[model samples]
Target: MTLTPTKLSKSEKTRQAILEAAQTLFYEKGYDGASVRQIAEAVPIDPAMIMRYFGSKEGLFSAAALVDLRLPDLGSIPRDLAGKGLVRHFLMLWEGDRSGIGLPILLRSAVSNQNVADKIHEVFEEQVVPAISGLVPEGEEDSCAGLIVSQLFGLALCRYILRLSPVAEMTEQEIVERIGAVIQFHLDAARDTAGSNRP
Candidate 1:
């Protein structure tokens, strides 16, 4: 509770340890499967300490689910290449970081837990929608955003979770090339539909 540098540093370390342990458990066992006792065991900390830091399992999960997609600024990307850029960025995030626990934890837990699913939806709706809203036709942002989310997450689920054959074996570049085109088409179609609908 004190603001001393040493105390603050130690507190932060314990907090991070709890989060890392919780993420691993959540990734391997899902929300319902991963319990506070298991997380505490993984961290080698007391369950009470975890409660002291995060309050409850839901609170801990909320903290652990935090992830920044670091989506590229669409305005800076070439208009034609936006889809390629977006897809490539996600591919990099997925394949490039074996040590990353954020996205995988969220993806894995979301399958069985309504809370995690809702959190995932909230994250994309808040972050992805605003990022590409300007590029989409007025009033079509939500639908367009949903389309983009489906393609990207679908690719992830097939390749990462389900480990389907061609998708699992394909190189990142192959994924970027194939999926990027589809994403681009969706973007273009959204804009086209908006234009046609305008008075």
Candidate 2:
């Protein structure tokens, strides 16, 4: 007689449960406050299981913390308002706690871990750079891209991560209008710099 294997093994189910519990606790309480035992207790499992599956709390955090940027198509954006579009898009993605959970976790972990730092670099190189490149000239791609990322990420830190009052209270359109101009200016400056360097 032949027998079919179950789709999800008991161990896999337990592992998933542990991660889910950990995410909830981490979200409710900051990462520094959440303990392994607290995470395991929520799942009604031994904390040792988390160590077995993920090696440590940091490892579990890395595996469980994932985010999709859902960046808009840069080519389709209007040339006059690419700046506004970028600001709006980033704010929209970050404003909601549900969609933005991963950013907070990643921002916290990136301070200490090289692997996490590299992962964040990949995120910018892949997602932010490509999205902004279409707005700048071909040769100036790298410099312009780096400047834009720094500005936008700085705004994110002020508004979302640090929750600065003046920045946090402004309406979305107000922020876009204010910040977008700076972004567009840098982009233009980069293109000019690249042109000057050419033979």
Query: Which candidate ranks first by TM-score, i.e. highest?
Result: 1
Clashing pairs in 1: none
Query: Largest lDDT belongs to which candidate?
Result: 1
Each model's TM-score, in the order given?
0.90, 0.76
List candidate 1 stretches off by more than 4 Å: 1-8, 98-100
Off by over 4 Å in 2: 1-17, 24-34, 42-45, 51-58
Q: Note the Cα lDDT for every prediction shown.
A: 0.85, 0.76
Per-residue lDDT of candidate 2, residues 17-102 (tens digit) = 78778766765565666789999889988889899999998888776666567778878967767778777877876776555566
Clashes of 2: 0
Residue 31 displacement in candidate 1 (angstroms)? 0.8
lDDT at position 111, candidate 2: 62
**Residue 126 lDDT in model 2?**
83
